[model samples]
Target chain A: MQTIGKLSAATGVKVPTIRYYEQVGLLPQPARTQGNQRLYDRRAVQRLSFIRHARDLGFPLDAVRELLGLADDPDRSCAAADAIARRQLHEVNARIQRLNALRDELERMLRHCACGTISECRVIEVLGSHAHCQGGHIEGADLAGD
Target chain B: MQTIGKLSAATGVKVPTIRYYEQVGLLPQPARTQGNQRLYDRRAVQRLSFIRHARDLGFPLDAVRELLGLADDPDRSCAAADAIARRQLHEVNARIQRLNALRDELERMLRHCACGTISECRVIEVLGSHAHCQGGHIEGADLAGD
Candidate 1:
Protein backbone atom coordinates (compact mmCIF):
# COMPACT_ATOMS: atom_id res chain seq x y z
CA MET A 1 0.00 0.00 0.00
CA GLN A 2 1.10 3.56 -0.71
CA THR A 3 0.06 6.90 0.75
CA ILE A 4 -1.72 9.55 -1.32
CA GLY A 5 1.50 11.52 -1.76
CA LYS A 6 3.31 8.41 -2.89
CA LEU A 7 0.50 7.64 -5.29
CA SER A 8 0.68 11.18 -6.64
CA ALA A 9 4.44 10.89 -7.01
CA ALA A 10 4.08 7.57 -8.77
CA THR A 11 1.40 8.78 -11.17
CA GLY A 12 2.61 12.42 -11.53
CA VAL A 13 -0.94 13.56 -10.83
CA LYS A 14 -1.35 16.41 -8.35
CA VAL A 15 -2.78 15.65 -4.92
CA PRO A 16 -5.81 17.90 -5.24
CA THR A 17 -6.48 16.65 -8.74
CA ILE A 18 -6.35 13.09 -7.44
CA ARG A 19 -8.92 14.03 -4.86
CA TYR A 20 -10.94 15.72 -7.59
CA TYR A 21 -10.81 12.54 -9.65
CA GLU A 22 -12.18 10.65 -6.69
CA GLN A 23 -14.85 13.26 -6.10
CA VAL A 24 -15.88 13.03 -9.74
CA GLY A 25 -16.12 9.23 -9.47
CA LEU A 26 -13.17 8.70 -11.80
CA LEU A 27 -11.13 7.12 -9.04
CA PRO A 28 -12.72 4.73 -6.57
CA GLN A 29 -12.71 5.26 -2.84
CA PRO A 30 -9.26 4.37 -1.66
CA ALA A 31 -8.60 2.47 1.52
CA ARG A 32 -7.55 4.53 4.53
CA THR A 33 -5.12 3.76 7.31
CA GLN A 34 -6.01 3.81 11.04
CA GLY A 35 -4.87 7.47 11.17
CA ASN A 36 -7.26 8.34 8.29
CA GLN A 37 -4.53 8.75 5.72
CA ARG A 38 -5.42 7.59 2.21
CA LEU A 39 -3.89 4.33 1.10
CA TYR A 40 -3.73 3.09 -2.46
CA ASP A 41 -3.03 -0.34 -3.76
CA ARG A 42 -1.37 -1.33 -7.03
CA ARG A 43 -4.77 -1.16 -8.77
CA ALA A 44 -5.10 2.49 -7.78
CA VAL A 45 -1.68 3.16 -9.16
CA GLN A 46 -2.58 1.62 -12.52
CA ARG A 47 -5.98 3.33 -12.62
CA LEU A 48 -4.48 6.71 -11.87
CA SER A 49 -1.83 6.18 -14.49
CA PHE A 50 -4.49 5.31 -17.04
CA ILE A 51 -6.43 8.43 -16.14
CA ARG A 52 -3.35 10.63 -16.36
CA HIS A 53 -2.41 9.23 -19.75
CA ALA A 54 -5.94 9.61 -21.08
CA ARG A 55 -6.15 13.16 -19.75
CA ASP A 56 -2.81 14.07 -21.34
CA LEU A 57 -4.23 12.79 -24.59
CA GLY A 58 -7.02 15.42 -24.11
CA PHE A 59 -9.91 13.14 -23.08
CA PRO A 60 -12.55 14.85 -20.95
CA LEU A 61 -13.40 13.53 -17.50
CA ASP A 62 -16.67 11.97 -18.63
CA ALA A 63 -14.93 10.22 -21.50
CA VAL A 64 -12.25 9.00 -19.15
CA ARG A 65 -14.96 7.53 -16.94
CA GLU A 66 -16.39 5.67 -19.87
CA LEU A 67 -12.93 4.39 -20.75
CA LEU A 68 -12.34 3.24 -17.17
CA GLY A 69 -15.61 1.39 -17.25
CA LEU A 70 -14.55 -0.39 -20.40
CA ALA A 71 -11.13 -1.17 -19.00
CA ASP A 72 -12.64 -2.68 -15.85
CA ASP A 73 -14.65 -5.17 -17.84
CA PRO A 74 -12.24 -7.12 -20.02
CA ASP A 75 -14.96 -9.09 -21.80
CA ARG A 76 -16.75 -6.07 -23.23
CA SER A 77 -16.28 -5.30 -26.89
CA CYS A 78 -13.68 -2.59 -27.59
CA ALA A 79 -15.99 -0.73 -29.96
CA ALA A 80 -17.08 1.66 -27.23
CA ALA A 81 -13.50 2.57 -26.46
CA ASP A 82 -12.77 3.08 -30.12
CA ALA A 83 -15.83 5.28 -30.47
CA ILE A 84 -14.69 7.42 -27.56
CA ALA A 85 -11.26 7.90 -29.03
CA ARG A 86 -12.80 8.72 -32.39
CA ARG A 87 -15.05 11.29 -30.80
CA GLN A 88 -12.08 12.92 -29.12
CA LEU A 89 -10.26 12.95 -32.41
CA HIS A 90 -13.20 14.73 -34.01
CA GLU A 91 -13.23 17.36 -31.26
CA VAL A 92 -9.51 17.92 -31.61
CA ASN A 93 -9.92 18.39 -35.34
CA ALA A 94 -12.71 20.89 -34.87
CA ARG A 95 -10.69 22.89 -32.35
CA ILE A 96 -7.70 22.88 -34.62
CA GLN A 97 -9.81 24.26 -37.45
CA ARG A 98 -11.29 26.99 -35.28
CA LEU A 99 -7.88 27.94 -33.92
CA ASN A 100 -6.47 28.10 -37.42
CA ALA A 101 -9.15 30.59 -38.36
CA LEU A 102 -8.34 32.72 -35.33
CA ARG A 103 -4.65 32.54 -36.14
CA ASP A 104 -5.34 33.74 -39.66
CA GLU A 105 -7.37 36.66 -38.40
CA LEU A 106 -4.68 37.62 -35.93
CA GLU A 107 -2.06 37.40 -38.61
CA ARG A 108 -4.10 39.59 -40.91
CA MET A 109 -4.59 42.17 -38.20
CA LEU A 110 -0.89 42.25 -37.43
CA ARG A 111 0.02 42.41 -41.09
CA HIS A 112 -2.13 45.48 -41.67
CA CYS A 113 -1.10 47.27 -38.50
CA ALA A 114 0.39 50.71 -39.25
CA CYS A 115 2.14 50.89 -35.87
CA GLY A 116 0.64 54.33 -35.40
CA THR A 117 -1.88 55.22 -32.64
CA ILE A 118 -4.62 53.07 -31.10
CA SER A 119 -7.14 55.07 -33.10
CA GLU A 120 -5.48 53.86 -36.30
CA CYS A 121 -4.28 50.49 -34.98
CA ARG A 122 -5.45 47.64 -37.16
CA VAL A 123 -5.39 45.21 -34.24
CA ILE A 124 -7.56 47.44 -32.10
CA GLU A 125 -9.70 48.36 -35.03
CA VAL A 126 -10.35 44.77 -35.97
CA LEU A 127 -11.28 43.90 -32.42
CA GLY A 128 -13.30 47.07 -31.82
CA SER A 129 -15.33 46.76 -34.99
CA HIS A 130 -16.51 43.38 -36.18
CA ALA A 131 -17.09 44.87 -39.65
CA HIS A 132 -13.31 45.08 -39.97
CA CYS A 133 -13.16 41.29 -39.71
CA GLN A 134 -12.75 39.36 -42.92
CA GLY A 135 -14.20 36.09 -41.69
CA GLY A 136 -17.13 34.94 -39.53
CA HIS A 137 -14.78 34.29 -36.61
CA ILE A 138 -17.13 35.63 -33.95
CA GLU A 139 -18.67 32.35 -32.80
CA GLY A 140 -18.58 33.56 -29.15
CA ALA A 141 -16.21 30.72 -28.27
CA ASP A 142 -14.29 31.33 -25.05
CA LEU A 143 -10.88 30.04 -26.12
CA ALA A 144 -9.24 30.14 -22.70
CA GLY A 145 -12.12 28.36 -21.01
CA ASP A 146 -12.27 25.70 -23.66
CA MET B 1 -29.94 55.66 -22.41
CA GLN B 2 -31.10 52.06 -22.59
CA THR B 3 -31.88 49.34 -20.05
CA ILE B 4 -29.57 46.40 -19.35
CA GLY B 5 -31.75 44.23 -21.57
CA LYS B 6 -31.41 46.72 -24.37
CA LEU B 7 -27.65 46.70 -23.97
CA SER B 8 -27.70 42.91 -24.09
CA ALA B 9 -29.75 43.01 -27.26
CA ALA B 10 -27.60 45.72 -28.83
CA THR B 11 -24.28 44.06 -28.02
CA GLY B 12 -25.33 40.40 -28.09
CA VAL B 13 -23.63 39.92 -24.75
CA LYS B 14 -25.61 37.93 -22.21
CA VAL B 15 -27.04 39.94 -19.30
CA PRO B 16 -25.14 37.93 -16.71
CA THR B 17 -21.92 38.25 -18.69
CA ILE B 18 -22.43 42.03 -18.86
CA ARG B 19 -22.77 42.06 -15.11
CA TYR B 20 -19.62 39.97 -14.93
CA TYR B 21 -17.86 42.50 -17.14
CA GLU B 22 -19.01 45.23 -14.80
CA GLN B 23 -17.80 43.27 -11.83
CA VAL B 24 -14.47 42.74 -13.52
CA GLY B 25 -14.20 46.47 -14.25
CA LEU B 26 -14.36 45.92 -17.98
CA LEU B 27 -17.67 47.78 -18.20
CA PRO B 28 -18.10 50.88 -16.09
CA GLN B 29 -20.76 50.98 -13.39
CA PRO B 30 -23.90 52.16 -15.10
CA ALA B 31 -26.44 54.76 -14.04
CA ARG B 32 -29.21 53.31 -11.88
CA THR B 33 -32.85 54.28 -12.06
CA GLN B 34 -34.80 55.17 -8.95
CA GLY B 35 -36.34 51.69 -9.17
CA ASN B 36 -32.79 50.25 -8.90
CA GLN B 37 -32.60 49.15 -12.53
CA ARG B 38 -29.29 49.37 -14.42
CA LEU B 39 -29.16 51.91 -17.23
CA TYR B 40 -26.51 52.02 -19.99
CA ASP B 41 -25.74 54.56 -22.63
CA ARG B 42 -24.13 54.46 -26.10
CA ARG B 43 -20.63 54.08 -24.66
CA ALA B 44 -21.70 50.93 -22.84
CA VAL B 45 -23.06 49.52 -26.04
CA GLN B 46 -19.79 50.16 -27.86
CA ARG B 47 -17.62 48.88 -25.02
CA LEU B 48 -19.67 45.70 -24.63
CA SER B 49 -19.52 45.07 -28.34
CA PHE B 50 -15.77 45.53 -28.30
CA ILE B 51 -15.47 43.07 -25.45
CA ARG B 52 -17.74 40.55 -27.13
CA HIS B 53 -15.79 40.74 -30.37
CA ALA B 54 -12.46 40.38 -28.58
CA ARG B 55 -13.77 37.37 -26.68
CA ASP B 56 -15.14 35.70 -29.81
CA LEU B 57 -11.72 36.02 -31.43
CA GLY B 58 -10.33 33.92 -28.54
CA PHE B 59 -8.60 36.69 -26.62
CA PRO B 60 -8.32 35.86 -22.96
CA LEU B 61 -9.91 38.22 -20.45
CA ASP B 62 -6.61 39.81 -19.51
CA ALA B 63 -5.64 40.42 -23.09
CA VAL B 64 -9.09 41.81 -23.72
CA ARG B 65 -8.57 44.15 -20.82
CA GLU B 66 -5.28 45.35 -22.24
CA LEU B 67 -6.88 45.92 -25.61
CA LEU B 68 -9.73 47.81 -24.01
CA GLY B 69 -7.30 49.99 -22.14
CA LEU B 70 -5.53 50.82 -25.34
CA ALA B 71 -8.82 51.60 -27.05
CA ASP B 72 -9.81 53.94 -24.26
CA ASP B 73 -6.72 56.05 -24.94
CA PRO B 74 -6.67 56.95 -28.62
CA ASP B 75 -3.20 58.53 -28.53
CA ARG B 76 -1.23 55.56 -27.07
CA SER B 77 1.20 53.88 -29.43
CA CYS B 78 -0.35 50.86 -31.16
CA ALA B 79 2.77 48.80 -30.53
CA ALA B 80 1.27 47.40 -27.32
CA ALA B 81 -1.81 46.24 -29.12
CA ASP B 82 0.28 44.73 -31.88
CA ALA B 83 2.37 42.87 -29.35
CA ILE B 84 -0.75 41.47 -27.70
CA ALA B 85 -2.11 40.29 -31.04
CA ARG B 86 1.23 38.71 -31.86
CA ARG B 87 1.27 36.94 -28.51
CA GLN B 88 -2.22 35.60 -29.03
CA LEU B 89 -1.23 34.39 -32.48
CA HIS B 90 1.73 32.57 -31.00
CA GLU B 91 -0.49 30.91 -28.40
CA VAL B 92 -2.99 29.85 -31.04
CA ASN B 93 -0.18 28.39 -33.10
CA ALA B 94 1.22 26.43 -30.19
CA ARG B 95 -2.23 25.07 -29.37
CA ILE B 96 -2.74 24.05 -32.98
CA GLN B 97 0.54 22.19 -32.95
CA ARG B 98 -0.28 20.38 -29.72
CA LEU B 99 -3.73 19.45 -31.00
CA ASN B 100 -2.28 18.18 -34.25
CA ALA B 101 -0.01 15.88 -32.31
CA LEU B 102 -2.96 14.65 -30.28
CA ARG B 103 -4.96 14.15 -33.46
CA ASP B 104 -2.18 12.09 -34.93
CA GLU B 105 -1.94 9.97 -31.79
CA LEU B 106 -5.70 9.40 -31.69
CA GLU B 107 -5.70 8.45 -35.36
CA ARG B 108 -2.89 5.97 -34.76
CA MET B 109 -4.75 4.34 -31.88
CA LEU B 110 -7.95 3.97 -33.89
CA ARG B 111 -6.10 2.62 -36.90
CA HIS B 112 -4.48 -0.17 -34.88
CA CYS B 113 -7.66 -1.38 -33.18
CA ALA B 114 -8.53 -4.94 -34.19
CA CYS B 115 -12.23 -4.55 -33.42
CA GLY B 116 -11.85 -7.36 -30.96
CA THR B 117 -12.40 -7.40 -27.16
CA ILE B 118 -11.22 -5.06 -24.42
CA SER B 119 -8.61 -7.56 -23.32
CA GLU B 120 -6.93 -7.06 -26.69
CA CYS B 121 -8.08 -3.51 -27.35
CA ARG B 122 -5.33 -1.26 -28.64
CA VAL B 123 -7.15 1.90 -27.51
CA ILE B 124 -7.37 0.77 -23.90
CA GLU B 125 -3.94 -0.78 -24.06
CA VAL B 126 -2.32 2.40 -25.30
CA LEU B 127 -4.04 4.39 -22.59
CA GLY B 128 -3.36 1.86 -19.85
CA SER B 129 0.31 1.56 -20.78
CA HIS B 130 2.38 4.60 -21.69
CA ALA B 131 5.05 2.41 -23.26
CA HIS B 132 2.64 1.88 -26.14
CA CYS B 133 2.95 5.58 -26.96
CA GLN B 134 5.26 6.24 -29.88
CA GLY B 135 5.82 9.91 -29.13
CA GLY B 136 6.44 12.04 -26.06
CA HIS B 137 2.76 12.97 -26.08
CA ILE B 138 2.47 12.94 -22.30
CA GLU B 139 3.44 16.53 -21.65
CA GLY B 140 0.89 16.58 -18.80
CA ALA B 141 -1.01 19.31 -20.62
CA ASP B 142 -4.68 19.39 -19.68
CA LEU B 143 -6.22 19.55 -23.14
CA ALA B 144 -9.75 20.28 -22.03
CA GLY B 145 -8.68 23.01 -19.69
CA ASP B 146 -6.50 24.67 -22.25
Candidate 2:
Protein backbone atom coordinates (compact mmCIF):
# COMPACT_ATOMS: atom_id res chain seq x y z
CA MET A 1 0.00 0.00 0.00
CA GLN A 2 1.08 3.57 -0.64
CA THR A 3 0.16 6.89 0.98
CA ILE A 4 -1.45 9.70 -1.09
CA GLY A 5 1.89 11.48 -1.44
CA LYS A 6 3.50 8.29 -2.65
CA LEU A 7 0.65 7.79 -5.07
CA SER A 8 1.11 11.36 -6.33
CA ALA A 9 4.81 10.72 -6.87
CA ALA A 10 4.05 7.47 -8.65
CA THR A 11 1.37 8.99 -10.91
CA GLY A 12 2.59 12.64 -11.22
CA VAL A 13 -0.86 13.87 -10.12
CA LYS A 14 -0.90 16.25 -7.18
CA VAL A 15 -2.22 15.00 -3.81
CA PRO A 16 -5.08 17.47 -3.70
CA THR A 17 -6.02 16.53 -7.27
CA ILE A 18 -5.95 12.88 -6.33
CA ARG A 19 -8.41 13.57 -3.55
CA TYR A 20 -10.46 15.66 -5.96
CA TYR A 21 -10.58 12.78 -8.43
CA GLU A 22 -11.88 10.57 -5.68
CA GLN A 23 -14.50 13.16 -4.74
CA VAL A 24 -15.56 13.49 -8.38
CA GLY A 25 -15.79 9.67 -8.77
CA LEU A 26 -13.00 9.56 -11.41
CA LEU A 27 -11.03 7.48 -8.92
CA PRO A 28 -12.27 4.80 -6.61
CA GLN A 29 -12.12 5.55 -2.90
CA PRO A 30 -9.19 3.72 -1.44
CA ALA A 31 -8.80 1.85 1.82
CA ARG A 32 -7.59 3.87 4.81
CA THR A 33 -5.06 3.02 7.49
CA GLN A 34 -5.86 3.06 11.20
CA GLY A 35 -4.86 6.74 11.34
CA ASN A 36 -7.36 7.46 8.53
CA GLN A 37 -4.75 8.26 5.90
CA ARG A 38 -5.52 7.21 2.33
CA LEU A 39 -3.85 3.98 1.33
CA TYR A 40 -3.79 3.06 -2.32
CA ASP A 41 -2.94 -0.30 -3.81
CA ARG A 42 -1.04 -0.98 -7.05
CA ARG A 43 -4.34 -0.92 -8.95
CA ALA A 44 -4.86 2.71 -7.90
CA VAL A 45 -1.47 3.61 -9.31
CA GLN A 46 -2.31 2.08 -12.69
CA ARG A 47 -5.77 3.74 -12.77
CA LEU A 48 -4.40 7.17 -11.93
CA SER A 49 -1.64 6.85 -14.50
CA PHE A 50 -4.30 6.14 -17.11
CA ILE A 51 -6.34 9.19 -16.04
CA ARG A 52 -3.27 11.42 -16.17
CA HIS A 53 -2.32 10.20 -19.63
CA ALA A 54 -5.82 10.83 -20.99
CA ARG A 55 -5.98 14.31 -19.47
CA ASP A 56 -2.55 15.18 -20.82
CA LEU A 57 -3.83 14.33 -24.27
CA GLY A 58 -6.60 16.97 -23.78
CA PHE A 59 -9.53 14.59 -23.41
CA PRO A 60 -12.34 16.35 -21.60
CA LEU A 61 -13.19 14.99 -18.16
CA ASP A 62 -16.42 13.44 -19.47
CA ALA A 63 -14.48 11.66 -22.19
CA VAL A 64 -11.88 10.60 -19.65
CA ARG A 65 -14.61 9.16 -17.43
CA GLU A 66 -16.09 7.23 -20.36
CA LEU A 67 -12.64 5.99 -21.38
CA LEU A 68 -11.97 4.84 -17.80
CA GLY A 69 -15.26 2.94 -17.72
CA LEU A 70 -14.41 1.25 -21.01
CA ALA A 71 -10.91 0.49 -19.77
CA ASP A 72 -12.21 -1.22 -16.63
CA ASP A 73 -14.01 -3.90 -18.63
CA PRO A 74 -11.20 -5.78 -20.36
CA ASP A 75 -13.54 -7.98 -22.37
CA ARG A 76 -15.37 -5.05 -23.94
CA SER A 77 -14.86 -4.04 -27.58
CA CYS A 78 -12.52 -1.08 -28.31
CA ALA A 79 -14.99 0.69 -30.60
CA ALA A 80 -16.04 3.12 -27.87
CA ALA A 81 -12.45 4.10 -27.19
CA ASP A 82 -11.84 4.69 -30.88
CA ALA A 83 -14.94 6.90 -31.12
CA ILE A 84 -13.94 9.00 -28.13
CA ALA A 85 -10.48 9.56 -29.58
CA ARG A 86 -11.95 10.53 -32.93
CA ARG A 87 -14.29 13.05 -31.31
CA GLN A 88 -11.40 14.56 -29.39
CA LEU A 89 -9.37 14.78 -32.57
CA HIS A 90 -12.22 16.61 -34.29
CA GLU A 91 -12.48 19.15 -31.49
CA VAL A 92 -8.73 19.71 -31.57
CA ASN A 93 -8.84 20.24 -35.31
CA ALA A 94 -11.64 22.79 -35.00
CA ARG A 95 -9.70 24.68 -32.38
CA ILE A 96 -6.62 24.68 -34.56
CA GLN A 97 -8.55 26.16 -37.47
CA ARG A 98 -10.01 28.87 -35.28
CA LEU A 99 -6.61 29.71 -33.83
CA ASN A 100 -5.10 29.87 -37.30
CA ALA A 101 -7.73 32.40 -38.34
CA LEU A 102 -7.02 34.45 -35.25
CA ARG A 103 -3.29 34.30 -35.91
CA ASP A 104 -3.81 35.58 -39.44
CA GLU A 105 -5.79 38.55 -38.19
CA LEU A 106 -3.28 39.39 -35.48
CA GLU A 107 -0.44 39.10 -37.92
CA ARG A 108 -2.17 41.48 -40.28
CA MET A 109 -2.81 43.95 -37.48
CA LEU A 110 0.80 43.89 -36.35
CA ARG A 111 2.14 44.22 -39.87
CA HIS A 112 -0.03 47.28 -40.53
CA CYS A 113 0.63 49.03 -37.22
CA ALA A 114 3.44 51.29 -38.64
CA CYS A 115 4.58 51.70 -35.01
CA GLY A 116 2.77 55.05 -34.90
CA THR A 117 0.61 56.80 -32.32
CA ILE A 118 -2.51 55.00 -31.06
CA SER A 119 -4.80 57.23 -33.16
CA GLU A 120 -3.08 56.05 -36.35
CA CYS A 121 -2.43 52.51 -35.04
CA ARG A 122 -3.75 50.00 -37.55
CA VAL A 123 -4.07 47.42 -34.76
CA ILE A 124 -6.61 49.63 -33.01
CA GLU A 125 -8.21 50.58 -36.29
CA VAL A 126 -8.68 46.95 -37.33
CA LEU A 127 -10.04 46.01 -33.94
CA GLY A 128 -12.44 48.97 -33.86
CA SER A 129 -13.89 48.22 -37.30
CA HIS A 130 -15.94 45.04 -37.70
CA ALA A 131 -15.72 45.43 -41.49
CA HIS A 132 -12.00 44.55 -41.41
CA CYS A 133 -12.54 41.23 -39.61
CA GLN A 134 -12.94 37.87 -41.26
CA GLY A 135 -16.24 36.17 -40.56
CA GLY A 136 -17.02 34.15 -37.40
CA HIS A 137 -16.58 35.30 -33.83
CA ILE A 138 -14.59 32.78 -31.83
CA GLU A 139 -16.43 33.10 -28.55
CA GLY A 140 -14.18 33.49 -25.50
CA ALA A 141 -16.74 31.46 -23.53
CA ASP A 142 -16.39 28.54 -25.95
CA LEU A 143 -12.63 28.55 -25.43
CA ALA A 144 -13.31 28.63 -21.68
CA GLY A 145 -15.42 25.46 -21.98
CA ASP A 146 -12.53 23.66 -23.66
CA MET B 1 -27.60 58.01 -25.75
CA GLN B 2 -28.29 54.27 -26.00
CA THR B 3 -29.69 51.78 -23.51
CA ILE B 4 -27.67 48.69 -22.51
CA GLY B 5 -29.96 46.55 -24.65
CA LYS B 6 -29.27 48.75 -27.66
CA LEU B 7 -25.54 48.53 -27.01
CA SER B 8 -25.84 44.77 -26.90
CA ALA B 9 -27.70 44.78 -30.20
CA ALA B 10 -25.16 47.10 -31.79
CA THR B 11 -22.07 45.25 -30.61
CA GLY B 12 -23.20 41.58 -30.65
CA VAL B 13 -22.25 41.44 -26.99
CA LYS B 14 -24.99 40.21 -24.69
CA VAL B 15 -26.53 42.46 -22.01
CA PRO B 16 -25.08 40.51 -19.10
CA THR B 17 -21.63 40.42 -20.64
CA ILE B 18 -21.68 44.21 -21.13
CA ARG B 19 -22.58 44.57 -17.49
CA TYR B 20 -19.80 42.12 -16.67
CA TYR B 21 -17.33 44.25 -18.65
CA GLU B 22 -18.49 47.23 -16.60
CA GLN B 23 -18.08 45.35 -13.34
CA VAL B 24 -14.59 44.26 -14.42
CA GLY B 25 -13.58 47.84 -15.37
CA LEU B 26 -13.25 46.92 -19.03
CA LEU B 27 -16.20 49.18 -19.74
CA PRO B 28 -16.56 52.51 -17.97
CA GLN B 29 -19.51 53.01 -15.69
CA PRO B 30 -21.85 54.99 -17.87
CA ALA B 31 -24.07 57.89 -16.82
CA ARG B 32 -27.56 57.07 -15.48
CA THR B 33 -31.00 58.62 -15.97
CA GLN B 34 -33.35 59.78 -13.23
CA GLY B 35 -34.85 56.26 -13.29
CA ASN B 36 -31.35 54.88 -12.48
CA GLN B 37 -31.02 53.04 -15.76
CA ARG B 38 -27.60 53.08 -17.45
CA LEU B 39 -27.16 55.56 -20.31
CA TYR B 40 -24.39 55.17 -22.88
CA ASP B 41 -23.02 57.59 -25.44
CA ARG B 42 -21.57 56.87 -28.89
CA ARG B 43 -18.12 56.59 -27.28
CA ALA B 44 -19.33 53.75 -25.06
CA VAL B 45 -20.72 52.00 -28.11
CA GLN B 46 -17.34 52.21 -29.89
CA ARG B 47 -15.39 51.13 -26.83
CA LEU B 48 -17.67 48.16 -26.11
CA SER B 49 -17.47 47.15 -29.77
CA PHE B 50 -13.67 47.25 -29.58
CA ILE B 51 -13.69 45.08 -26.45
CA ARG B 52 -16.07 42.60 -28.02
CA HIS B 53 -13.97 42.36 -31.17
CA ALA B 54 -10.72 41.88 -29.26
CA ARG B 55 -12.33 39.19 -27.11
CA ASP B 56 -13.70 37.37 -30.16
CA LEU B 57 -10.13 37.14 -31.43
CA GLY B 58 -9.09 35.25 -28.25
CA PHE B 59 -7.22 38.03 -26.41
CA PRO B 60 -7.11 37.16 -22.72
CA LEU B 61 -8.75 39.67 -20.41
CA ASP B 62 -5.42 41.09 -19.25
CA ALA B 63 -4.20 41.62 -22.80
CA VAL B 64 -7.55 43.12 -23.69
CA ARG B 65 -7.24 45.48 -20.75
CA GLU B 66 -3.80 46.59 -21.87
CA LEU B 67 -4.98 47.07 -25.43
CA LEU B 68 -7.88 49.16 -24.12
CA GLY B 69 -5.52 51.27 -22.04
CA LEU B 70 -3.34 51.84 -25.07
CA ALA B 71 -6.40 52.74 -27.12
CA ASP B 72 -7.58 55.24 -24.53
CA ASP B 73 -4.38 57.27 -24.86
CA PRO B 74 -4.50 58.50 -28.43
CA ASP B 75 -1.04 60.11 -28.34
CA ARG B 76 0.75 57.11 -26.74
CA SER B 77 3.14 54.99 -28.79
CA CYS B 78 1.63 51.79 -30.24
CA ALA B 79 4.58 49.59 -29.21
CA ALA B 80 2.63 48.03 -26.32
CA ALA B 81 -0.25 47.10 -28.61
CA ASP B 82 2.15 45.55 -31.10
CA ALA B 83 3.84 43.55 -28.38
CA ILE B 84 0.54 42.22 -27.04
CA ALA B 85 -0.56 41.11 -30.52
CA ARG B 86 2.83 39.49 -31.14
CA ARG B 87 2.63 37.61 -27.84
CA GLN B 88 -0.88 36.43 -28.61
CA LEU B 89 0.22 35.21 -32.03
CA HIS B 90 3.06 33.26 -30.46
CA GLU B 91 0.67 31.65 -27.97
CA VAL B 92 -1.69 30.70 -30.79
CA ASN B 93 1.18 29.17 -32.72
CA ALA B 94 2.28 27.12 -29.72
CA ARG B 95 -1.23 25.82 -29.15
CA ILE B 96 -1.47 24.82 -32.81
CA GLN B 97 1.82 22.96 -32.60
CA ARG B 98 0.75 21.06 -29.48
CA LEU B 99 -2.63 20.17 -30.95
CA ASN B 100 -0.98 18.94 -34.12
CA ALA B 101 1.25 16.63 -32.12
CA LEU B 102 -1.75 15.39 -30.14
CA ARG B 103 -3.63 14.83 -33.40
CA ASP B 104 -0.80 12.76 -34.78
CA GLU B 105 -0.77 10.52 -31.69
CA LEU B 106 -4.56 10.12 -31.59
CA GLU B 107 -4.66 9.39 -35.33
CA ARG B 108 -2.00 6.74 -34.97
CA MET B 109 -3.83 5.16 -32.05
CA LEU B 110 -7.11 5.01 -33.97
CA ARG B 111 -5.49 3.52 -37.04
CA HIS B 112 -3.78 0.78 -35.06
CA CYS B 113 -6.82 -0.21 -32.96
CA ALA B 114 -7.82 -3.18 -35.20
CA CYS B 115 -11.29 -3.34 -33.55
CA GLY B 116 -9.84 -5.73 -31.01
CA THR B 117 -10.76 -6.44 -27.39
CA ILE B 118 -9.83 -3.82 -24.77
CA SER B 119 -6.86 -5.85 -23.59
CA GLU B 120 -5.43 -5.77 -27.11
CA CYS B 121 -6.59 -2.20 -27.80
CA ARG B 122 -3.93 0.05 -29.32
CA VAL B 123 -5.68 3.12 -27.88
CA ILE B 124 -5.25 1.76 -24.37
CA GLU B 125 -1.76 0.57 -25.16
CA VAL B 126 -0.70 3.96 -26.51
CA LEU B 127 -2.19 5.79 -23.52
CA GLY B 128 -0.64 3.42 -21.04
CA SER B 129 2.86 3.82 -22.43
CA HIS B 130 4.44 7.28 -22.30
CA ALA B 131 6.95 6.11 -24.90
CA HIS B 132 4.08 6.05 -27.39
CA CYS B 133 3.46 9.80 -26.94
CA GLN B 134 5.40 12.33 -29.03
CA GLY B 135 6.63 14.61 -26.21
CA GLY B 136 5.54 17.09 -23.52
CA HIS B 137 2.52 16.94 -21.26
CA ILE B 138 -0.14 19.51 -22.11
CA GLU B 139 -2.06 19.78 -18.87
CA GLY B 140 -5.77 20.49 -19.19
CA ALA B 141 -5.31 23.05 -16.43
CA ASP B 142 -3.13 25.16 -18.73
CA LEU B 143 -5.86 25.21 -21.32
CA ALA B 144 -8.30 26.42 -18.64
CA GLY B 145 -6.01 29.33 -17.80
CA ASP B 146 -5.81 30.41 -21.44
Q: What is the TM-score, restricted to chain A, for candidate 2?
A: 0.92
DockQ of 1: 0.73
Q: Write the per-residue lDDT of candidate 2 for residues A46-140, one digit (tens) a residue.
A: 88988988887888888999998988888999988889999998987787777777878888778877998889999888888888766644654
Where model 1 places Cα greater than 4 Å from the true spot, the runs are A142-146, B142-146
Q: Which residue pairs in candidate 1 collide?
A: none
Highest lDDT, which number? Answer: 1
Q: All candidates' lDDT scores?
A: 0.88, 0.84
Tens-digit per-residue lDDT, A1-146, candidate 1: 99999999999999999999999899989999999989999999999999999988988888999999999999999999999999998888888888888888888889999999988999888887788888746466645522
Q: Give the TM-score of candidate 1.
A: 0.94
Q: For model 1, what is the error of residue B39's alpha carbon versus the real structure, in angstroms, after optimal superposition? A: 2.2
Highest-DockQ candidate: 1
Q: What are the candidates' individual DockQ scores?
A: 0.73, 0.64
Model 1: lDDT of residue A22: 94
